[model samples]
Target: MTNQQFKSTLQALSLPANRSAIVGIKRGIERETLRITEQGRLSAKQHAAALGSPLTHPSITTDFSEALLEFITPAQSDAELTIKQLEDIHKFTLAHIGDEILWPISMPCFIKHQDEIALAQYGTSNTAQMKTLYREGLKNRYGSMMQAIAGVHFNISLPESFWQTLQTIRQNTQPKQAFISDSYLGVIRNFKRNLWLISYLFGASPALCSSFLQGRDTKLPFEAFGKGSLYLPYGTALRLGDLGYTNSAQSALNVTYNNLDQYISGLKSAITTESDLYRNIGTYPDGRLKQLNHNILQIENEFYSPIRPKRNTAPGEKPTEALARGGIEYIEVRALDVNPFSPVGISLEQVYFLDVFITYCALMPSPDMSTQQQQETQENLSAVVNAGRDPELCLVQDGQSISLKQWGQTLFTDLRAVARYLDDAHNETHYVAVIESLQKAIADPEQTYSGQYMQQVLNSGLDNGHFVFELAKQYKANFAASDYSVYSEAEFEQMAQESDQQRLQIEQSDTLDFNAFLADYFKA
Candidate 1:
């Protein structure tokens, strides 16, 4: 695909009957907080009984640590509606969590000790045991503190009709699933090339508690604020930088998104490839399973990319198996931080802007990325995460240097066109309005969430940790006081009861021993 071909395809797809692209967006938010106490220490309490079983809840679950709450929203075509539903989930969850406040920031600020962070416990079922064992492996590899860092994942998928429209434009002769998957891979390549812009614009974890570093060596020159908070004046998102959740082992895999088969093969091989470091730990230690295997990955989900090709797996089906069985059902964007300004962690404007950006990626001419380009992408992401707010920052693109602002403006110009198309298709001006507001952020870095948050903390005369903790309390109060607009109280109660029952049934129905089950799962 070329720029000219992209323009012609956009023109063809803009026909009145084909104008609307049915898009579905899903969100999974993972938040971690110190227990609601006068001292703000990590909580030792289990998942609240009132919030339902973490093992079986449809919309709520635990992630990494027992204190880390993850809320999930079903797919919706309307960004506003999707956010509204997420808000409702927050409202209902807050009402149930007793005194706990949802953490307002991505980096955990108040953790006192690694021993204080408990691995999430899903009950006695074989499957549940596997989940905990995998976490144990992560704990051994990355430490629980790093695993406790929170973020949001945005999953989006274009409908069959949207792909059919593209197929007609391209005269694609392959099977529909193959074409859709290949098209998604192309978009993913472009996403990798341009993700630095997203980190620069939306990254919010610029500062963190000095305690978070735990004496690790770093080149980052830090200034101290109230109560030992460490900050870099021009830093963007340290959470996505070297300080964040990363695996050196996966970096060596060099997974490429050039095609679906290659992507799946890379993932499968990583899952099967044994690691010397992990092998030393062994699969069974002290007569209990330490991990699923000594492989580089416990599962495909552990590959830890900024984005993933997703297909909702069937019962007992592995993620790689699902993609190999059926082409990608969606792509999950994993680079977003937990925006401290929004009660639900993301705003409607952010959602709408992502729609425009992802659509542009789909339509753009994305040449396949080579291994060298992959390394360059990582470098660009690092540059943005560390010093994106610096006016003179430059990013590598196609082996050439470009100013971050120049590339951002260029991308935004194309995004405006996308917004126009979306607005026309939906018979509304909302998408255009989103682009206009984001345009201001591009022109002025101070308008970005990261920039605004830094300024807010500085003006408040509080450490970053204390500032976010105050915001967390405020959000907790607001959500607790709000009425559930999307779900009734009865509905929430019913769902909780059902989830608990499902967990019980799963526990009672397990037929295989834990060791045998792990063996069979890996074999499958």
Candidate 2:
């Protein structure tokens, strides 16, 4: 669509009759960080008893490793309230963990080898064992070192009210749920096309401690930062690039974000398809469970994408089954790196920027992507991750070349207009202003989080490890000095106790043997 046409559509959406429909934009955050000791070594401690059970806790849990803490905030319409809950989670966690501090970045603390990382454990139950076995499969398929890298997932959805209004505006004929599902798929398509901008603006892992490489050979041109660090001078998020969790095997899987049924069918196919490479790892080698089934993807979650259409599943329901049953309830953006500068690992400005971007994707026109176009978007996103700040870099669009700055400027014209409509609907004043700041960051790459943080490392002459440790210490001190604001200490204590009980109940409720449990789960 032309810029003027998109502007007219926004104007209609912002009319008094339709304004409040956009006000119900809901969001949730899932932030992950590794736990490190005072000296910056990865912690060897198990999941602390003071914290709730990692398996059942509503707010706190472990990710791939026991040391990697994942904090979840409930979905709320107000981003400020969501962030405040995150802060309270941080304060309550710090009060319990004695001296260990949360790492301030997406990349992990210095580790000698993958063996130092412990798999996250759940209490012994058929269900819990399946969870661990899935992780074991991940470890066997992709090394544990890659899983150690952390990120923040932004989950968002437009309420039913919003979708209803959108259907009316378009005068669509499909059923409400079907329309919502199709609309969300369009959003995913646009999101993929524009993901490069996100990586350039918020990506923060341009440098890494040399330990992450573990003497592996690489082709990317990386210069030495300090005694024990290697860096790409113009890179944005190395964590989203080849060094982090990758999908080289799934590249040919053809999971297109075209339509809900096709998308679901594509992912399900990978789960049941066997892989000769992973088959060699042996699912039950050494008289013990080494991994899950030797499939291209052991489960739906293993089909790593930067974004996914999600539905809260019923008991024993697979993710695709849930989607087919109820359609898309939300979209989880998995491309974000944990902002090292923010105490909560994501800043309010970042949230606001995403708010504008996501909403614009929903309102704008999105067509089905051809296979060639999908490949181009992936290649463009990879280019930004590896060399976003390089002035000489250009991305391919419609099989033509365009510089990042020029394209971003054009995108902001629509984004800023969308922000104005969001601000009016939400009755908050931050959207337009936040978009302005983000627009500036787009024009000037040095203003991006990765650019600023990497420059600090260069100027301070501290090794990557020492520099991150100092930041982690400062954030720890901040959390320590702050009092609980959103959740009370007593409330947190009660939740931990309740979560433990819930975990025990689940363990006791398991009726099937572990092997039978696996068989039953796959049958679903």
Candidate 3:
């Protein structure tokens, strides 16, 4: 879709121009953790005793934007811009948003004595190890004793310098795995699963949460932030800008095409080797070499094969109509983590940070980033994730390495400006507070959640059980006094019944035996 067509469609939908969209993120996974706890309700004294009593504070409290762009126009549909309009928005976002990277690997895992002795399995997904540790035994062992901080992701449009920086990092060379893995998948799954739990607390009907949870054994629920969840909250969505807008049918087609295009591009880039595997894929003393191409092809066919690129259009076809023939457009923000200690499942601080980061991304200029620059961004992001609490890690920007705190400060400075704008434009005071707290965190790194996590670990001796339990305590505290618009007793009963029916429906729909599916899933 062309940019011009896209703008006119927005003029038609009359989507709020100045208002910002917000949604509650909650989860049932942790609630399930609480449900199975043997300790019943933990009293204040009991909570303190569980911790070794170093930094035992009874109470804790916390407080918690978009842009205009030239979107690709899609054909107009249903008197509104169609799906093609959305893709045009993404093209605009891609062309306009800027980003920053944080490294998650450098953070400490906070292993406790129980974790040390427990027979636990690491997840095969990105967050698998933590999930397996927490779900299988940690909840029983720790309760709410854990503390953790997740790395943040900011999507900045690629720029010329961004490419140069990444290329330099890749060329300089380092031995590390690049492909997504079980650990990565686990982290994402846990984080997303928790969002549903939070939403439950946010006044979403029990029916809604339960609907998402059907057939799930563990408390973890559906992936709430489906591909498009992230961008919807951002004020500067692809939905706006100049892009071609077609009728609704054409709009859907455009989104489908874009999604397929991304999948194909990702598959084409999935090449890896023994050096990049979690465990080297090659190096058998007895002899065989790694079949990198075979592994890549397998993933492509099994996973990405389902996606087909949009069919070609005849010459002179309108951008919106042509792309809308097939496709959908959506945004996926991947930086959020479940605030294990917060009842709401995410902190007001975290939410505000996301708003700030996304707004910044929307406003930043897009320069064509090189592969190397992307690698640098990726590496730096990992470092932030893993070592955000560490004061010494250096972040690279404009050809220089600066302390993580310094880099964060610089980022915060920019974010605050955006927050001020959001406040004026959307009348959101919460955004301002979020910016201030982020700035404070940058100034005193220990003040941030990551710092608190390290401190708790030191005081509690990294007991996985203790850490998880303590963290859960904090989570309870965060939401206990706060008003949670939850279902009443009578309402809850109705939802429970509905949940049973939903499960039955799912069971009936399955052709393969449940046990068979389970067998194949676990074996795979």
Candidate 4:
């Protein structure tokens, strides 16, 4: 905790009748994208019924495929008004995407095949056929082109009067959802022990498009380009490394965070265990169901974590029954990576340096990480997502070996005193000039955004698929020549006709049938 004990507990919670102690820094983002085409492949289109109803859109959706998409932005406490509401949801989804584009990296550059992608479609409802049967059980357990890899989540939260001013600066008398679910699991164990300093300061996918290794079998070396790209001259976010969403049955489910009932009893025993490799990938084969559960998690958001502990679930609960009925209400960072030099892929100084590094991972001092400090936080997040700007890199903190620029100059000198206590609780130096521009991307990893997008694809000799397909056609012509400053094209066409009449009133008020709604959603 010491950065002078979090600046004397933010000067005794900035007393002026605790002026709502820096006004509840909420936030929210989500992001994701893909919908390719003008020669950059992917797009087997379909999600555009004039951009809405990706299951009753509150802010457009579609994630595991049907040309990806996923924009969301509601919660806001001005991180430049949540990036001007994600640039007005990418200018109302590029004014209903007529000539596709969006895909500006987090890997997956171009693909001519992988059964030409597809998945996401939500029509008949038993909750939109269990959200496309959980992306057909993630394409029968990871494939449909590694679920078209995309990124950025963010979410964050901190208000119940800033956790009652950190439970009155720790003179604790618990229970307000158990001290905000154990202070959001001590900010997800100091954001998994300093989330590889946010994947070495916003690790942008350092290179790919060798059809995202569609013929797997790496041993590192990489290097090629133009006729099937592939890189690693010190890569940074090979989409959160091990070539994205690494899995061996969730690395044998050794999930634990030390609290929140041992992290919802290891996600309800990986959603009621069972799995001979997802029971030979068959929840229903010939008669086609293909994945609501042969288990090793056909739920609990399939346990992939770069930070989670969220809550907001209700109408028919389940996100572990809203954290076993109200506990950790928000955290969801999900290791970022989708800046692609921001044209709305996120920026406003990377959303005010991730609100000053998630408020210095909720005022530091977090401990409980064991299991060999969670395998030295996955080997310091795979050494900053595979060779973080390699000039003799090194990481793994609490178990020694430092120098990733001296642990990013000791976490930007404690994130410049948490960006000067959030610019003295919002009188605002804009989070101390976003910690002096992230301490110059920790003393120059070529001023980050994955080292200036690998020096703009090595000074534009083009080939990370025509340099992200000519910068995704100049960020879809600068989000179609921008204009919807915070919504209204007749309110996004009346929210695309009320998300297509609330998805036809939840498919005419259904009455259990997709196998009795997956047996009352896994009866628990």
* lDDT per model vs. reference: 0.82, 0.89, 0.30, 0.80
Best prediction by lDDT: 2
lDDT tens string, model 4, 247-307? 7568768678778888888888888989788787744536877888788888888788888
Model 4 has an lDDT value of 0.80
**Which regions in candidate 1 have their CA more than 4 angstroms from the true location?**
22-38, 282-285
Candidate 2, superposed: residue stretches over 4 Å from native: 2-5, 283-285
Q: Model 1, residue 295: displacement in angstroms?
A: 1.0
Candidate 1, 1-524: lDDT as tens digits: 47677678778878887887544334433333333443455667888888788899988888898888888877766666677778887888777777777787788867677878899998999989999999998988778888878888888887788888888788889999999999899889989988988888789998898878886788887788887798877788888888897887778895799998899888888899998878877555457766678889989878888889899899988888899999899999989888888887777787788888888899998888899999899999998788888888898877889998888888888888888887887788999898988888777888888899999999999987788878888887887778777888788788899999999999999999988988888887
Q: Candidate order by TM-score, highest to lowest?
A: 2, 1, 3, 4
Best by TM-score: 2
| Range of the 10 consecutive residues with the lowest summed lDDT in candidate 4 | 13-22
Which 10 residues in a row give candidate 2 its minimum summed lDDT? 1-10
Task: Give the CA lDDT, 0 to 100, for residue 233 in model 3.
Answer: 15
Off by over 4 Å in 4: 1-8, 11-112, 116-143, 146-177, 182-200, 206-285, 290-307, 310-319, 329-332, 337-356, 359-414, 418-438, 442-446, 456-521
Return the TM-score for candidate 4, rounded to 2 decimals: 0.33
User: TM-scores of the models, in the given order?
Assistant: 0.96, 0.98, 0.43, 0.33
Residue pairs clashing, model 1: none
